[model samples]
Target: MLGQAVALLCLLAGDAGGLAFANAEPAWREKERLLENNKTLPCAASGTCSLGHTRQWTGDIYPLQGLRDCLRARVYRREIILVSENRLVAGFQLYDNMMQMGYDHIVLMSTEENCKRALRAWPQVSCIWSSQVFAATPKYMLDRHAFLPRAARLGVNVLCLDSDSMFLSDIYSHLKAPPLRDMALMALKDPAIGWLNSAVVYVQNARPDGPSVYVLNEVIDRLERWAEAREYMLGRNRKDFCWEQMAMSDILMSAVIGRPIAYGCWNWDRNVTYRDAWEGAHKRYFGYNETGGIGSWHFLKETKVPWPKSLAEHAPGFRRTEGVTHQQVIQIPNTQGVWPEEFGGPLYAPVRGNKSRAWMELIKSDGMPLWADPEDPAQAAANAANRELFTYLPEWIGIAYGQDGTSGYWNPALYRGANGTGTSPYALAHFYRLFGAPMNKLTVKMANNMWNWELSHLLHPRGGVFFASTEHAPIPDVLVYSPEVENREWVSHEEWDKATKALTRLAMEMGRTVVYPAPRCNLTWLGGERNNHLPLEIPMQFKHQCIPYSPSGKGFNDNRCMLGGYLMQGCMAARWYFAGGMFPPEYDHLVVHIRDKAAEHPVATVAAEQLARSWDSEELAKTLMAQHGGLGAGLFHPKIAEKLGAAAVPAVPAAAQKPRVLIIPSVLQLTDKVGPREQLYRDHEREDFNVMSCPWIQNKPFV
Candidate 1:
């Protein structure tokens, strides 16, 4: 009975200890030993290593060569070690992500009892856990205990990580031991204390002095002190002492013998800001918010974190205007923010003289250069007109163009001469019509069909072959043109050839149009023969009406900058009158010129205008149909005219019978350029009136 009782008591004690091991600190000793080994030894082969005072060989074993391939190709370590109680799910997820990142060795440490239970539950994730480890140590106790039985493991390093950490991207490439300090420490920045989070730590055993054995010891000692301090403060006796935090504060304040820990912004986000300041031509502001928005703030009291300056607060002659600069930040309202009151509506300007002074030129007054004339009165007026007209256009038109990636050539001028007209026929034909003008039929030919070098040509000085920087650069005896256009130089034949080949290759790769030597072509009122060689030479008086269409050769790169320039210039001109409609590459200029001729020859012009209108009218019809029918109209299908109201009398031909018109709702009208929606409804009276809505402008009917 005594022997049996003794045996039963021993079994019971073992079971109780097993339960404790399974509960907590099962992997503690193993983790501790590995930490110590990594801090002391080096890698013998690649994956296998030793820990603490014992050398042990621990790695994943595979029987097949193919299976080993997975281990080697993935750059995985032989094995990994981990500690947990009931965190198997977390453990496996962490293991998989890390394994893909190249760490292979997996060592799971739990209480012996839990280990048995967990292994039975999850056989795929093979792990080893022994209850031999009872507490946390500076070194891995499991590794240490296993070292004596197995001698193959030695000089191996270990990397320890907490379960909460996540890898954003592959960090192995940037991973390296930081510069070693004698007594290095990481500090976290807190409300009361500025320091680092000690959750994740890097341990390098590259010290020639046989590793820092006292490093972990010191940390453990500090941890003990921290716990003791916490317990003492929370005691029921209410001893005369500061809080646990106060103890930490005391330790930090006593900079007597311990080395200070260095902490910085690396591997973490830091809240840092600056004050607005300026020097010379430079301004500096760095104010930002937690949500990534930038702004300025004035605090009654200083914040715990350093505040940064606003990006726009500093300037050379900065003035704080209340309405303009709100909260010390310049509000640039984009798609998300509330747009300022001045954002939308018809831009109105005082009307200038109706007609050009010189009959030969369209305008007598000098105008501002393109793109840099938002403030110029004439430019502003033109732009305002363009915006107003833009509203009436059906949204589908823009959508269609966007889908088709509207095609056109961009042009640049190469040579400028005294007689040189800065425009091209193709440009005149396309650009003018887009602005609601009649198109002119005039074909443009290239000087060299071999290349499309329009941008460089436009930058070239006086219609000459010489480079801007060279001595041979053309000098106009009477005048020097604008420096921006004059600064471009003519490239040599070799350079041109190389450029052409390169451009061709690029175009082929990107599948875009290949255009070269783009001349500003304005074909309006100019005949094909008249504008054929418009940019070939610059003698302003060289108007040989019968210039050949094929100047150099046939089947060459003919799309010149003239075509592009003409289109753009036409768009600019269109801005003056018409509000809606995109510049069409196929028939815009043709329609405009035909409309112009319609005045002289009403029959032909009317026919051309009808066709032009038809094209846009078709798009308008499709847009309305989609709005009503929830589908796009077929391009080839005949348009079904729906009359919402009576058509107005034709102002041009009294006998011409007007067609029925479909009226667009006033609400939809303001959707594109809305302003003060409530005010708009309040201003316009509700009445039974018909609105003439063709796909084109108010009077212009689409075909």
Candidate 2:
């Protein structure tokens, strides 16, 4: 026991691959013992160590004891350890997010200098150098969780994720230990999908019975198959995703087979609002309401949980002014109160002049603003035009004041609600878009508001479900684009709106998210001539969008600053004055680029009243049609006679739950027989565990 403890402690104290344990008992025994006495272990600054905990384990787990000792964070000792991969733009934002949510044991695997410098100030935080994570290729996903085995070896459960995952409240509450199940999945029942984001994952022991290890192996196996089957990419930035989703989707949906293997969720929804860059960027102003009602907060069909209804009611009150920053109103802290009515909208700016200048941007001439120049036809015309156009947008696009009372990407409207504002916070949002530290007023206000709200919803055992629900990472329901037409001409808002209006109207009717082409930044329109348009980028309604200056790329990883992803986020909004279609590898359709000016015609975004039936052999299809309308998920032809039937039924959500199956061998018959619920259903059924219980037979979709 002492030898094993020394070995594990040695591993933490700059020893890599030096210890070889012949017996699992000793290693496993010390694993918990050291962890139990982790506080006594040497710390970074504490003189209790030999060489002082070194950085970069090369491929081993960098000693994480700094936080536990220096700041008493006891990071690895916590049952639910939160880990994330941090890169540029994702720095510090994720760290502050988890801390503000009050999660104590947090580690951000980041090598960026900014993250290192920033986190270095606080000994409570662990900033690790991780090259095996956030890889540019899908094959690297196997490396993504290499740290998990280390955590498992230490007997701690880990929740691994990407840096963009913004937690709304206390994730610790849902994930904190009591050992409810082998794995607590972050997904919804309806989608019946598992591993929604792949960014957020939870793991326990590496044993076969441990669901985390099982699911992870399955994900790696699936990725291995896909990687083998995949075509080679010609370029360096081969950004491919949705790798583990299909296989995990099969594993999670076993409830459809009446025998599920530890599928799970959190907080009623599977971590809602994964991806919402295009749609959410517009939600700062007004949006559609729930009940699919005709109201402002309409973040429909995006994820398991859409944007909360709490903020929707306040949307219309957000932007009183559009695209114009009021001189110098005090930038005040809006924490713990109703969302203050500061001016602004989550809308695009009219890029009609040079230097990416918005027509509404404060234009100074003769040392005075041009907005005051009524004599200037362009200024007068620009103001009139934007106001008239606002009514047509899918959601309100009030270009409002951001941080510092100037036009900024940080939208105040986003933090208006009191509950979970950031779902795993935001995924796929471009970095540098209103990004910074915990001190940022917007970050504080959002975190504080969620903490205040969570006061009422602490997890309770009698409350019924074992874990909280989570959702898929953000992915575009539909991607809308328009060619900037050789990067020379600009798409007029009228034409842009007309095209998007037609497209979004159709998509919404189909219950899908629809996007209109809104460039993150704009270019100058010089003398209406091709050669005259100097490529000077400027401040506009949408800031932080460096795409115009960035070299275009095929995907997210290709962008130099990670900014050039409009086709991958860029060039599409660059070249296409107008384009419409779903993003590639998921849905296939090329965007139809409309002419920049005077083009008022379009259609073909694919819309209908309902889904057209798609199926296999006519015999099965016909039988399904004749009986159950259509086969959903899968089908089991009225079976080879078991003389027994167990219908589909989801277990009711509970606050906490016991093991789904409690087995007793025949030789060891239980003194207490099966619970009355199990006894009653002995013929082939069990009592309701609620609608989502995996053990209960719900092999088919209720529909």
Q: Which whole-number lDDT from 0 to 100 does residue 613 have in model 1?
A: 25
Return the number of clashes found in candidate 1.
Answer: 81
TM-score of 1: 0.22
TM-score of each: 0.22, 0.29
Model 2: worst 10 consecutive residues (lDDT sum) = 387-396
What's model 2's lDDT at 580? Answer: 17
Residue 347 lDDT in candidate 2: 11
Give the poorly placed runs of model 1, Cα more than 4 Å off: 1-86, 109-114, 124-156, 177-194, 206-213, 222-703
RMSD (Cα, Å) of model 1: 33.7
Report the C-alpha displacement of residue 481, candidate 1, in angstroms. Answer: 66
Per-residue lDDT of model 1, residues 110-172, tens digit only: 444544554444332334443322122322332222221111111122233433333222222
Worst lDDT 10-window in candidate 1: 388-397
TM-score of model 2 (CA atoms): 0.29
